[model samples]
Target: MELKKKPTKKDNFVFLFKGSPLNDFLYPFKKAANQWVARYIIVTFAIIIRCAVGLGSYSGENQPPNFGDFEYNRHYMEIVTSLPLYQWYLQDLGNSNFMLKFPPLYAYHSFIWGIIGKLINKSWFELNNSIGCQDIDLKSFMRITVLFSELIAYIPSVIIYTRWMGRHYNKAPSIDQTIIAATILFLPDLAIIDHGHFQYNSFLLGIALIALNNLLYDNLALASIFFTLSICFNPMILYYSPIFFFYLLSLCFVPKFNLIRLIYIGVSVLLTFIVIFLPFIYSGGIQLLSHILYTTFPLNFNILHQSYPNFWSMTNHLLNNNIDLSNLKNLSIILTILAISPSCYAIFTNTSKRLLPWCLASCSLSFFLFSFLIDETSVLLPWMPVTLLLNEVDADVISMICWFFNTCLFSLMPLLKKDGLLLQYFVLGVLSNWLMGNLSWVRKFVNIIIPFISQRPNATPVLPHSYSWTATIISFYVTATIILSCDLLQIQPLVEIENFWEISNTFLSTISFGIFYVWLNFKIYTIHSLKAKSD
Candidate 1:
C-alpha cells in the first residue's frame, strides 16, 4: 500500500469544514472567479424573484368599497402630483379612505413617482377620477416603481454591507458574502409586503441600511444624515431611534468629550431634515409642519391593536373591555421604555462598535413587542437589524437569528393571508429556510414521510444541539398547523369568541417574541461583559 501523505494545516482546515452548511452551499463557487460570477447570479436571481412576486395578487385586488393599501398608495401619488404642495396633507386628512400619514419625504417620493405615472398614462393619475382606477398599466407601473426602489436602494445597500463585513468582520469568502446577501434579499416578510402586498418599505429600509453601513465605517456625520433621511421617509424608523441616540451620545464622551464631532453630526441631521421639509415649510410654515407631525405620530387611543402580534395585541381581548384605552396606552409606553432601557444602558456604557447591531436589535424588538399603535408589518423593523448578525461566528447566535426571523415571518401570516398571498408566503418561506440552512429537521421529517425523496447525506444541523433545534422546529410547525387549520378548515372557536384563531395566533406570536426579547437582552449584556473583559 502507498504511504499516506501528512495532512497540511490548509488541508485540515478544509477537511474541518467539508460538510459544513456554508461550505456545502458554496461548494459550486470554490474558485474566486466563480464566486464573483455567483455573486452577480445571486443578485440577478433575487431581483427576478422580486419581479415575479410583484406579478402576484396584491392587497385588495378587485376588493370593492374600501380597497387596501395598494389603492391608498396610488391615491397618495395622485393627490401629491395633482394638488398643490400645501394641500397634500390637508387633502389626505380630509379623505378618510386614503390618508397621507407618512412624513414629507414620503410625500416627495409619491410626487416623484406620481409625475412618472402621469408621464406614462395621464388618465391613470387624472385628478378626481384616479381614486379607484384599476388600470392594468397603472398596476404594472406601480409595481415597477417598487422594484426599481429595491434595485436602487435596498439591493445595493445589502451588497455593500455584506462586502464590507466579509472583508473586515469575518474575512469570509466572496461566496459567503453572496450567501449573506441572498439571505437578506430573500427574506419572506419584505418580499411579501413590498412585492406581493404592495408598499415601498424597502426604499425606507434601504436608507436605514445605508446609515447602518456608515456606522460600521465610523462615518458618523454621513450616518446621521442618512438615518435622519430614513426617519423623514418613515417615522417607523423611530423604533430604532433610542439605541442610535444612546450609542452616538456615548461616542461623544469616549476617550474625551468630542464636542466638535457631536456638533458635526447634529448639524448633518438638522440640515437633512430642513432640506426634506423645505418646500412644506416655505409654503405653509409651522402650521403645516405641525399638521404633518400630528398626522405622522397620531397617538390615537381608539384602537389598542390593529392585527399586530405584540404584547398589547395578545392581551387586547381581555383588556379591551376591562381597562380604559388611555390608561392602557400609558401602560404600554411605560413597558416599552422599561424594555428598551437595558440595551440602551449597555450601549451607553460599552460603546463598542460590535455592540451596535445587538443594541439596535434589542431596542427595535422592545418597540415591536410593547410599543403602542403597532402594525403587524412593523415586525420588519426589528428583523432588519437581526439580518446583520447572520454572519456571526457563534452557533447559538446563528440559531437565535434564525429563530427570530421565523417569528417575524410567522407574525405576518394573517396579514399576508388577507392579501391572498398564501402561495407566495409558503414558497418564500421554504426558499429562505433552504437558502439560510435552517429547518433541516423539517426536511428530514418530510424525507422520512416520503421514502422516494432524497435527503442531503451530510447536511449539517443548524444548531449543534439537536434537541433544542428539534423543540423549536416542532413548535413552529405546531403553531403554523393550528393557525392554518383553523383558518382554512373554518373551525369554530371552542370558546364563544369572535376572531378566536386570530387572537390565538397573536398570543402565540407574542409569547415567542417575549422570549426572544429576553434572550436578546441577555445576549447584549453578555456581549458587554465580554467587551469589558477584553478591554
Candidate 2:
C-alpha cells in the first residue's frame, strides 16, 4: 500500500558528498553521537591553530635594550635558576626594566621551565649571557613552554567547567558543551596574547577558574587554596580578590554566623600563602616578605598610563602633563574602589552562586577601566568571566559578550601592531567571529547582494535583529579603517601631537570600554533584583 519515496534532488546531492572527507569529518557532529570524538577533534584543531599562530613573531622580536615581555619571561627564568630565593627579587633592582616584579610562585614556575630549557639546550638558560638572545631553538623551546602550560593548566580547567555546566545549569547536551569549550579555547585574545605575544596568563587564569568552580561546588577550603595560589602566581589576580572576599564573607553570615566555616577557610588561605612564601621566608626574613610585596605592587608615579585603553589614558591626553602625579594616583585609587564596591556589595547581599560570574565580570571590568597602572592585557580579566557566561542560552547575553570580546581585541591593536602581529591579529579575529556566528550576517548579506549565489544552510545570525548588529559592525569597520589607515599608511596627524595615532586608539577604546562597564553594572543590578524576587 505504501510506495517507497524516490530520492529527491537534495538527497541525491547529499549522497554525492556522503563519503567525502568533509562529510566524514563532520559525521560525528551531524549525528550528535560519540561526543568525545567530536570534542577531541575540535580540541586538536584548536591546538593546531594555536601552534600555527605561535610560529609568528612575538613581542619585541628583534628590538634590543627594551625587548618585550617574552624576553622578560626568559630573563626571569634565568634569575630564578641562578640566584638564591632571597636574591630573586633583588636582581637588577637598579635597572627597573630587568627587575623581577612578579610573585614568588611565578618565579618558581619559571625555575621549573628554566631547568627543562637547560636540559633541552644548555645555552638557552645561561645566566647573563641569555639576555636579548634570539636563538631559533631557544624561541621554539620557550613557545612550547607556553603551549605546554595551557595544556596542563588552562585547557583542563575549561573542560572541567564545561562538563560541570552540562551536568547542571541548562543541562546542555554533550555536543553543545564541547562547542562551548572550543569557543572559549578559540578566544582570539588569549591565544594571541599567550601564544603569539608570549605570557603565562592562561596558567594563572586556569587556576582562577578552578577556584571559581570549587566555590560553586561549596568547597570553601579548596576554593581558598586555589584562589590564593592564583594570586601568588600573578598579582593581576588581585582584580578578582574583592569579589571573592565578599562572597566568602557573605557565606559566613547569611545563613548564620558560622564560625567553623570561617576558621576553616581562613586557615586554608593562610596555609596556602605560607607554603608559597615559606622558602623565601626561610631564606630571608619578614623583611623579604615586605620586599616582595613592594615589588609586586610598585607605584609608578611617572607615567599616567602605559598606553592602556582606560580612564587614565583618556585623561592623560586631556591633562597634557598638567596633572600632579601623586594627586592623580590617589584619585585613581579612590575611583577604582568606588567603581568595584557596588559589585562587591551585590555579591555580599545576594550570596547566590549564579550571580558570581556577573559580579566577577563587573568587578574586574571596573578594575580594568578605573584602576591605576592598568595594562591592555588586563582586559583578559573581565573576558575570563564573560567567557564563563556563554553557558547561558540568553540571546542578549551572547550578543553583548560577542561585542565585548571584539572590543577587547580591538583595544590591543596598538600593542599588537607594535609587536608585528597585525596579520595574526586579523586572522584570529576573523576566525573568532566566524566561530561565534557573528559573521553570519555578513554571509547573508553577501548572498543577498549576489542573488544567484547559494546561501549556506547553517549560516544563521547569532542575533535575532540585524539593525543594531549592522550598525555595530559598520561603526567598528569605519573606526578600524581610520585607525589602520592613519598608522599603516603613515598619514600625519592634523594636530601636532606626539604618538597621535596611539593616543587616538587608546581614547576610542576607552569610550567603548566605558560604555560596556556601565551596561555591565546595570546588568548586574538587574540580575540581583531578579534573584531577590525569586528568593
Best of the candidates, lDDT? 2
Report the number of the highest-TM-score candidate.
Answer: 1
Each candidate's root-mean-square deviation in Å?
Answer: 3.4, 5.5
RMSD (Cα, Å) of candidate 1?
A: 3.4
What stretches of model 2 exceed 4 Å from their correct place? 1-27, 30-34, 301-305, 455-477, 492-497
TM-score of each: 0.91, 0.91
Number of clashing residue pairs, candidate 2: 0
Instruction: Tell me model 1's lDDT, rounded to 2 decimals.
Output: 0.80
Estimate the TM-score for candidate 2.
0.91
With candidate 2 superimposed using the best TM-score fit, by how many Å does residue 163's alpha carbon deviate from the native? Answer: 2.3
lDDT of every predicted structure (CA atoms): 0.80, 0.81
Per candidate, the number of residue pairs that clash is 0, 0
Cα displacement (Å) at residue 270, model 2: 0.2
